[model samples]
Target: MSFLHSLGLFATLGLIYGCSTTSSLTSAQQRDAYLQQFIGQTSQSIQARLDLNSIGYQQVLAPVANDQTLTYTVIRPVTIPVPIAQNPADIDAGNIPIPVTPRAQSYDVNLQCKIIFRLENNMAKSVYYTGRTC
Candidate 1:
C-alpha cells in the first residue's frame, strides 16, 4: 500500500512538471533559440494581411513587448470576411433586378506556423521577422 501511494504521487508530480515547461522559456538562451525558430518560420498559421490601413501586431501589444520577450500566436487561420456577392451574377438579363452592392464572403490566409519574438528592451527591437514585414 505504501509503495503504491508513493508511485502515484511521483507520477502526479511528473505530469505537473511536464506541463509547466510547455510555455516556460525560462532562460535568455532558451528565449533566443525560441526567437530564432520563431522568426525562421516562412509563414503564419493565421495570417491575414491587414488592409494597408488596418493595424498590424504592434498596436495590440505595445509597451510590454518593447521590454520583455514577447510571444503571440493563433491556433488557426486568420480569416478575413470578404463580403462576396452571394447573389448570382448570371441572372437573366431581361428581368434582372437592379444590382445591389455585392455581398462579401470570408476567405482565410493560412499561415504555416505561429509567430513569436524576443525583445531586449523598450523599442521595436529586431529579434526576428527581418525578411518579411509584420
Candidate 2:
C-alpha cells in the first residue's frame, strides 16, 4: 500500500513539473509564429504595422548609411496570487489587512523582437526578423 501511494505521488509531481515547463515553450512558439510575418518586409513597414512608438524601442544599430537594425521589446503584465496572512492578531495589529485576493505582480518575462534590414541604393534588399520571449 505504501509503495502504491508513493508511486502515485511521484506521478502527480512529474505531471505538474512537465506542465510548468511546457507552458514556456508554448509561449515561445506563439511568439515565433507572430514574428514570422515580418520576414521579407522592410523595417519601416514592420514599424508601421507594430507601432514601434507605442511599444518603445530598445537598440538601433546603424553602422553604415544603408544597413540598419532595430530592436523592440514588448512587455506584458501578469497577475499572480500571493499568500495571505495566517495570523489574525498580526492582521488586526497592522493598519492594512492581509489581502486574501491576488495582487498584481510583475513577472520577468519579456519578448525582444529584432528587425535587420539591408538597404542598397536606398531600397531594402534583405530583411530578417528574430524574436524570443522569456
Candidate 3:
C-alpha cells in the first residue's frame, strides 16, 4: 500500500474503534460524559446552556451555608415487562401451544434521575447524579 492509502486505513480503523467504544458505554456513563462538560462553569452559564423546561428537567436550588447545590430532576419512562395471564382460547390448537407459557405485558413507569451540581461561590465545583434512571 502507498503512504496515503496506509494513512487512510489507519484513520478509518481509529474512527471504527472510537465509535465502538462510545456505543458500548452505559446510560449512566453517557450521562456523566455529557454532564462533565459543565464542570467549572458558572451557574448562570449552566442555566443558559441547559434548557430545563425544554428538556423536561426540573431545576432546584438548595443553599448550604456559603456553598450551594443545584439539582436537575428529570423523569424517564421505563417500560417493564410483566407476565400476563394467557387466555386458553387464544392458543392455537395446531401449534400445540403450551398453556403454561406466560405472555409478557409491558407497562411504563416513571423513573427519575437527579443531576446534582455542587457550587462554591456560584461556580460549579463538581457534578454527580443519583436515582434509578441514572
Candidate 4:
C-alpha cells in the first residue's frame, strides 16, 4: 500500500510540473510596450537593441508618393503533430501486429511580429507593431 501511495504522489507531482511547463505567447500589451521604444529611433539603433539575425526589414512606398516606410517583421514557426489513436477493436479482431509508421499530418504554427516605422527626414517618426508572439 505504501508503494501505491508513493506512486500516486509521484503522478500528482508529475501532472503539476507538466502543467507549469506549458508554453504561451506574450501578452499583446507587453509586446506593444516593448515596440513603443523604437519610435524616433533610427533603424541602425533599433538593430542594435535586438538580435539582427532574427529581424527582417523591407522598404515600402507610403500612401503618399515619394514617401517611404521601413517595415520590420519577425516570424517564428512551431511545428505540432496531429494525434492518432489506435483502434483496439480492429486490432483484437484481426490479431494484427502494431504498424510502425510515421505520423501522417502536422502543422506549422506561425508567430509573427511586425513593426512599421514611418520615416521623416531619414529618422523614425512613428512606430507601430501588430501580430502574435510566443
Candidate 5:
C-alpha cells in the first residue's frame, strides 16, 4: 500500500508540473509563429498552404536576380465610436432638461496589415509586416 501511494503521488506531481510548464501565446504571437513555418519552405509549398487567390495576395517585386517579395494584406475590422446626440429634451416648467446627451455610436473600419515575404531561390527566407494593423 505504501509503494502504490508513493507512485500515485509522483504521478500526480508530474502531471501538475507538466500542466504548469505549458504556456499559451497571444493571438499575434501565435499568428507569427504559424507564419514562421513558411520559412525555408518553397514558394510552391507556401502557396499550397495559403490561399494565393485571395484578394489580399499580391506580388510586389523582385529586388535582386533571385530575390522576390510577396505581399499579403490582411483586413481587420475596427470599431470607431462617433459621438452623437442620443437624447434631447426641452425645458419643462419645473426643471430644464439637458439640451443634448452625447452617446457613442460605433462604426466599423477596415484596417489593413501588409505582410511581405522575401524569397530567394524560390524558397521563403524571411517575413516582414507593415501598416497600422501590424
Candidate 6:
C-alpha cells in the first residue's frame, strides 16, 4: 500500500497577468475618472497562475479516497491568416483597376489544459508506490 505511503494532496494556483481594455489617449489626459475605468493598454499576454504538481503513488488501484476530487483546465490561443499572391490574375491581370493584395500581420498565442481525476472505492483503500508527474 503506497500512495505516498499515506495519501495526501494539496494544490493552489491562481495568478492572472497582463491585461488590457483600451486606454491610450496619450495617457488619457493624466489618469483620473476612477483611474480611467481600471486603465488598459496591452502588449498582449495574459496568463499567470498555473502550478501543477502531483506525484506520489505506490500501487494505489483498488479503492482509496479520503477525499477524491481532482480537476484541471485552461486553454487560450487562436489566430489564422496567410495570403501572398503576385501576378497570377490580380483578379484578371491587373490594370490599375483592381490589384491590391498586400497586407501583413501576425498574432500568436496558445495555452491549453484539460484534466479530471476522481476516485473513491468505498471511501478509498489501495496502494503500491512509485512516482513522477508533478
User: Where in model 2 is the C-alpha error above 4 Å?
Assistant: 1-23, 51-66, 85-101, 104-133
TM-scores of the candidates are 0.24, 0.42, 0.55, 0.48, 0.51, 0.23
Report the C-alpha lDDT of model 1 over 1-134, residue by residue, as the tens digit.
47567656655564455444333445325534444543422223112221211222222322223244444532223443432232355465444655444332333443332244554433224454321223
What global local distance difference test value does model 1 have? 0.37
lDDT of 3 by residue, 1-134 (tens): 77567656655665555445433447546566667788899877886686544443344443222358777766654444433333456565444555442323333456567777899988898887787454
Regions of model 6 farther than 4 Å from truth? 1-49, 52-66, 84-87, 95-113, 117-134
How does candidate 3 score on lDDT? 0.60
Report lDDT (CA) for all predictions: 0.37, 0.47, 0.60, 0.53, 0.57, 0.27
User: Model 6, 66: alpha-carbon shift in Å?
Assistant: 10
Runs off by more than 4 Å, candidate 5: 1-25, 51-66, 81-104
TM-score of 2: 0.42
Q: What is the C-alpha RMSD of each candidate to the true structure, in Å?
A: 19.8, 9.5, 15.4, 10.6, 18.5, 22.6
lDDT: which candidate is best? 3
Tell me the tens digit of each residue's lDDT in model 6 across 1-134.
44342222110110111112122344323322222232131111101121222111122222222344223343333322322224345547654444444434222334343322333532212212122111
- Cα lDDT for residue 120, candidate 5: 85
Residue pairs in collision within model 2: none
Residue range with the least summed lDDT across 10 consecutive positions in model 6: 10-19
Select the stronger candidate by lDDT from 2 and 4. 4
Positional deviation of residue 11's Cα in model 1 after best superposition, in angstroms: 49
Give the deviation of candidate 5 from the true structure as CA RMSD.
18.5
After superposition, candidate 4 runs with Cα above 4 Å error: 1-25, 52-67, 94-105, 109-114, 129-134
Residue 90 accuracy (lDDT) in model 1 = 45
Give, for candidate 4, the lowest lDDT window spanning 10 residues: 57-66
In terms of TM-score, how similar is model 3 to the real structure? 0.55
Candidate 4 has a TM-score of: 0.48
